[model samples]
Target: MIDPTGRPPAEATGPRRAARPERLEGLVVGLVANPKKNAEQFLDAVGDLLAAEHGIADVVRTRKTSITDPIPPATLDELAQRCDVVLIGVGDCGSCSAAAVADGIAFEAAGVPAAVICTDAFRVSADAMARLQGSPGYAYVTTAHPVAPLDEAGVRERARQALSDVLELLVQAPVPVAAR
Candidate 1:
């Protein structure tokens, strides 16, 4: 279950912490687009919705060259420092969703609150959330399922919902201090 880095699959659960009030001023949304052609379009729509609905302060976007690979480590580290919370969308690829969740957890480990939105059509947003809750890497994971295939309208709604859930969780979860 553990990857080479000693991180386990995201489905493994850990002890819950007491909820804490969110101290973030504004949210930073991280969008991970699948390599598919429509990935960028979907991410843009999601970003626009987060801005309009959730008052997100900034949006950071990254695209993977392939579903099998992880996003660049530099990109993940940059996002962790710049954003209090990160939103990763898989663009309807379950395989990519798994990879993206791993990347999001890396962000969390570095002190950023992160949630991964599973874009797989077979799994509902709620299901994704459940899976993430159990995942070791994404102990703080959240999910958003679009009404249908990702389009401008669907992406907007889904992104808004996903961002809202992530913000709520981040506000409640205790902030982990950086190790000395």
Candidate 2:
């Protein structure tokens, strides 16, 4: 399909995909946490689950400055260099949720398997952002809404319930650009 500007389709910009590892076992995982309330707590629980259940060797965690903004290129580059697969999380609102999915796409573009976590309420927003960003059907994990007000036990329980889904998505091999 031709675009309006008479360009055949804007070619995806950036380095070609990095090599995807065969598995997550003993791999270094990157966690890009959005700076919304309890975002780190939510991701930390998920990270714990990844370590305990999936045998993820180590996690390099970074917090984005704000959810409404794009993830810093340096952080992505660093995670790309230091980690194998990544999990970007706590997209409980519209903007942050979209950012998480976009970040996931960026990780995949760089050949790292990634999954974005959000509340069920923001699932549609995350999926829509993925589509708008040229990668429709990007997989993500969702938990209950109102995560910010939740106590530790509440978030932990939500994390536990959602951990399996996050594990499944993070373990998958990166989809080749052609398939996307």
Candidate 3:
């Protein structure tokens, strides 16, 4: 069953007994970069990291039209149908970051695994994660931040860590068989 966080309960049995495996074979990784200059750079680095470090199968990158509104319906659908997981980077702006997090939640509801990367200074990553976790529209929310000054390596590392954490949680959590 779907939880308030919008994730299905853990699956039953075998190596995947506790949580789903990091099943990236044929999985598409969606990158949602905020329309800030640094955002694209960060996302590109993240895409490279996923491809190089984790060997993700495919990467699809898109940007939100505006920071305040939800991602466009077409974009959401594209990601949902083609992607196994999505990563969103919220630049330095808090409002924009929150909106992106909300958008990620919506994407999760559409059945794409999603995570958000916040600015390290804001410390809102955890709060955003909690908000998504408590909401009915998103079930598996995870957060990370690149150390400021925004270097490629930092962005890539943070992205890798956040994606890794989300996959681990998915693999570890008990899939709820019935609605809670």
Candidate 4:
């Protein structure tokens, strides 16, 4: 698939990124939840984990109008200016899964560390989206599939289960240096 930005694949460039902070305390968490069934609920649970455990000072949350559109550049720019790390998701279905990955790519391009969370069933879709976004080997975490049928507790549980991996990626993954 083509990039959402309408750039050709060869011209699809993401910004070179800075390293992740050594610690999470006092950081602001940027969250972009694709308007899938319960994406916001799931992302909020994960954001809460960071805040509760890492002392995150605040959260900036946005819900995209659709599951397929990337978070707008203006929104991403805002998050990049204000947040240390970002999390985007509810990639339970195909198109939304791609959008979630696209959002993470946007964060990475803006010099913010990010995790793109998808469901077990949409793994291929997420990977494909990453590849299309110029991050062929992008790291993503996952919960089980079909969140639309889940209750709040279920979605929260998925968030909790997905937390460790997401935190690991945000805290430990090496930042991609910009192409010189």
Candidate 5:
């Protein structure tokens, strides 16, 4: 079978995750927004929290042209060049969830630590995508589902609740499965 994700023959390997930063202070962050409903707002809220809580120096934000497709290589390259880390999000549906996970893996392959956020409803799809992409235990954050219907305050609340997990995914090294 042809592996479209470009995984090596080894089944246990995927994109090598970037090294975690010792501190969040002064580091540039990238936010890759999927064009799904309320995705930009959700990302904005998360960016605000990261800036407020972690002292991130700046955020370089970009919106993908399509929610169901992988991020364009040029955009991914730009983010990798300009940002220390990246957060991709608001994957509320199946296709977007898979795309987000793929984008996160691509960022990691570019040597940027990435945190991918999805709604709880799409967790199965996100996890499956990770495995398909050769990252069986890739870490991603999930918020409560149905983000499209949430008002600004509601979305921010979800962001607030997901903030800690976001921070952990960005700054902390993932423990090996064997260690867990």
Candidate 6:
């Protein structure tokens, strides 16, 4: 495994994924939004579902300044301090997909579990970005493509479709680097 800077890990075993919360009940969740169309709405829908179904206590939402850059380290630190788990996404295109995945990795390293959402059309780009961030095959959630053109209902449906996957990413057991 590689470091977040794309450097080789100091330990022979390498860096590992952050530990996931065993339960969502009463946990604070963060929603990091990209500036893509409808991204915030989708995140809100997912947040609502999580609150209703899994007893998420509260949600903290923020937006990244750019779609193509990682969330700033300061923001990651703040979110880590405020939230137990984070959801980031609506990565409908290549640049945003890469950014979202990178942010997810950064959040994980900061000791917060993050669920990154991307369109299936850009899954390859998301995976490549994870690898570039020194975390090859890093897991994330994927929905159908072209979210920018989606209506509110369409966006909600996509969120509904992706909710389970997002929860899984946030709470599932960490897959060891060697397992990959």
Top lDDT: which candidate number? 5
- Ranking under lDDT, best-scoring first? 5, 6, 4, 2, 3, 1
Q: Rank order by TM-score, top first? A: 5, 4, 6, 2, 3, 1
Candidate 4 positional error at 57, Å: 0.8
Residue-wise lDDT of candidate 6 within 1-180, one digit each (tens)?
222333332222223468888889999999999999999999999999998999999999999778887788788888999999999987988889888988887788888888999999998788777766667778888998888888989988989999889878889666789999
lDDT by residue (tens digit), candidate 4, 44-66: 99888988888899999988897
Candidate 2 residue pairs that clash: none
Deviation of model 2 at 151, angstroms? 1.1
Overlapping backbone residue pairs in candidate 5 total 0
Q: With candidate 1 superimposed using the best TM-score fit, by how many Å does residue 150's alpha carbon deviate from the native? A: 4.0
List lDDT for all candidates, in order: 0.56, 0.78, 0.59, 0.81, 0.86, 0.84
Better of 1 and 4 by TM-score: 4
**Cα deviation of 148, candidate 1, in Å:** 8.7
The candidate, 1 or 6, that scores higher on TM-score is: 6
lDDT of 1 by residue, 113-179 (tens): 6555564462433244334546432343443443345566665555556655555555675556864
Give model 3's TM-score versus the native structure: 0.65
lDDT of 1: 0.56
Worst 10 residues of 2 by lDDT: 1-10
Ten residues in sequence with the least summed lDDT for candidate 3: 10-19
lDDT of 2 at 20: 54
Regions of model 3 farther than 4 Å from truth: 1-21, 124-163, 166-180
lDDT of 3 by residue, 1-180 (tens): 112233343332211112234555556788888776567666677667667766788888888767556677888898878877777766456556656656666665676666666665544633453344445333333334434455766766666665665455333355578955
Q: How many Å off is the CA of 42 in candidate 6?
A: 0.5
RMSD of 3: 8.6
Predictions: Cα RMSD each: 6.9, 6.5, 8.6, 4.8, 4.2, 5.2
Compute each candidate's TM-score over C-alphas.
0.63, 0.82, 0.65, 0.87, 0.88, 0.87
Stretches of candidate 4 exceeding 4 Å from the true structure: 1-7, 11-18, 173-180
Among the numbered candidates, top TM-score falls to: 5
Give the least accurate 10-residue stretch of model 6, judged by summed lDDT: 6-15
